[model samples]
Target: MLEEQLLQRSENKCELCQSGETLKLYAVPPQSANNVDNCIIVCDTCLSQIEKNKETEKNHWRCLTTSMWSELAAVQVVSWRMLNRLSTEGWAVDNLDMMYLDDETLAWAKAAAEDENDEIIEIHKDCNGSPLLAGDSIVLTKSLDVKGSTLNAKLGTVVKNIRLVENNTDQIEGKIEGQVIVILTKYVRKQG
Candidate 1:
């Protein structure tokens, strides 16, 4: 219901980039409410980059300058978040200076970054420096002994469907011999 409303409100285009491709409902975080006021329509590119599931193209987010002035709170929140993420860029810094939000919305906009040290969203990567995401297959490049078990994960072991360890960029969880264990990302390479 809320998604339908957002879709109509956005004219079936991505509210941020105005792209009419592969739209999805992106709920503004820290609220988790499924209402129109807290959700915006986004394209696949925006969603993947926002979640750090893929590398962000800094140039792609230049649209924030226009979206920042949206009357919808959800759009403003996402715009503020993206602008903050790109704050190191000169244009982003200038737009952030010009953007304004009321006290309550400003607090909500800062919630995600406030607790993060350095305000940078961490990206998980494999030994080769390729970005890693949940459910990606990986091959162990070095042998590792399970800390509390007799199992020794051998070199060249294929660990299928790995889960990224949130809050830590250097580790991932995968099952070795039916035992789910944390593996250091440096010891594995993303499998094709």
Candidate 2:
């Protein structure tokens, strides 16, 4: 199986930190298929941090200084990506400057990085800076007068199952007073 192959290739240790505890396979992002070239063995700590399931420990990633030079393209790509994520640190910046990747590997790393950045940039937030998703309930923080009509959307109004306006982060659509109206995001707060 792929797990066995990865264990053998990684020498039964985490490829990034060389840890022998609780190791498992980690498929690199923007993955097209599962294979030795697209996966690496990682410990629970590394996996959790990489997946953002746990807080990142900057010192724990210092192992990248050595792993960045692995012969495997998968390892190199992950190392490069991690270094970029920790680029604010002087050591990580130095390591990134020293790391090298072939044209194809560099492209793969950049493609996945860009996808992550795009997702971060597209999130919609409410007046209090809380992230808003489709079908979420929100409360109007300020009363708004509907244009071209007599709709009075009063303050502290609860709008349920709101739909985010497509391609527009500044607005959401909700039914207030039995009429569907576009609401400004800055005037709403996400409801628990």
Candidate 3:
């Protein structure tokens, strides 16, 4: 019944890492967020692993020679990212020479990859840990009335997982009581 039923179809584990910690629904051909063919189930670790591919300036597909044969686009995407990241590896560079992506699928993958919004902010943990990244839900420990705001946030309130403000390091933004606000990450406890 979740928007991302793909997780259930793929089973609750990350398709790549196989870790079950947190399964999330992500759009594969991110352009089609509403289409099932474009959605996939991935965990935070696998998602980050796949995301690492986008940070690279140049990509080589040799590392994915075996992966290119995968029928699943999500698998292909993950493999492509890994191959791109592995371009510096000696084996990958040599293999890149033989890697071939069909013009259509390659174009689809490339277009999907490039369309991601890198400027989007991410919230993280407040106790000197990472920022409150997206899709992480947490519970509040103390009641707080946002400064300069009229909202009455209650204590022990469950704040659905939060997203971080990309450029800011101290705030985790979330919605509570139908109002969206930025909260100190330290004030919330990560839910299991």
Candidate 4:
């Protein structure tokens, strides 16, 4: 399978940070086919930051200083993109200055950049500022009074398998007392 090939290519380590934990295949953007040339193996941390599921940590990405020199075009393109994303940092800028990409690979990297610029991503977050995803469990930070119902959604209540409201980052849906209700995201905290 494709995953086996990527793991072999990456030596069972994350192609970005060389972390050998929870590795997964990541398809480089702007490419339609899933192949070794367009995909790289990355760890959960790298994958989370890459997909914007978590905030980017500058210290963690210092690995790009070495990964940018990879012979594979996919790894090079990803390193280039991450450098550009973190260009505000002096270290990232320095790395970008030294990194080079071929014309076609540069074009591919820029294509994803343009698409990123054109899209507006809405991420739902908990009261503690942690990103919330569908099927995540949350704890009520404040008690809520259900209108026209006797459901007691008290503080410290645990709501499991919550769903993010479509087109609305400020709200999520969860069941309480056998009834589903929309809860404001600010009143909840994501549970581990």
Compared with the true structure, what per-residue lDDT tens digits does model 4 show for residues 1-192?
Answer: 999999998899999999999999999988889999999999999999988889999899999999999999999988988888876566776677678899999888888978777232446778976778899999999999887898779999999999989899999999998899999999999998
Q: What is the TM-score of each predicted model, taking all chains together?
A: 0.60, 0.61, 0.44, 0.61
lDDT of 3 by residue, 1-192 (tens): 554476766677765555688777766655634565656667775565566644442333342555555577666665554554564454554444455667766676666556663222222454534334477777777798987788878878888857877676667788998888888877787676
Q: What is the C-alpha RMSD of each candidate to the true structure, in Å?
A: 12.4, 10.9, 17.3, 12.7
RMSD of 2: 10.9
- In the range 112-180, model 2's lDDT, one tens digit per residue, is 888777232344679976767788999999999998889989999999999989889899999998999
lDDT of each: 0.86, 0.88, 0.62, 0.89
TM-score of 3: 0.44
lDDT of 1 by residue, 3-111 (tens): 8998999999999999999999998887755798888899999999988889879999999989999999878988888887876576876687789999889888888
Better of 1 and 4 by lDDT: 4
Candidate 3, after superposition: displacement of residue 145 in Å?
78
| lDDT winner | 4
In model 3, the Cα lDDT at residue 187 comes to 79
Better of 3 and 4 by lDDT: 4
Which stretches of candidate 4 lie above 4 Å from their native place? 118-192
Supply candidate 3's per-residue lDDT for 5: 71
Candidate 1 regions exceeding 4 Å error are 115-192
TM-score of 2: 0.61
Off by over 4 Å in 2: 118-192
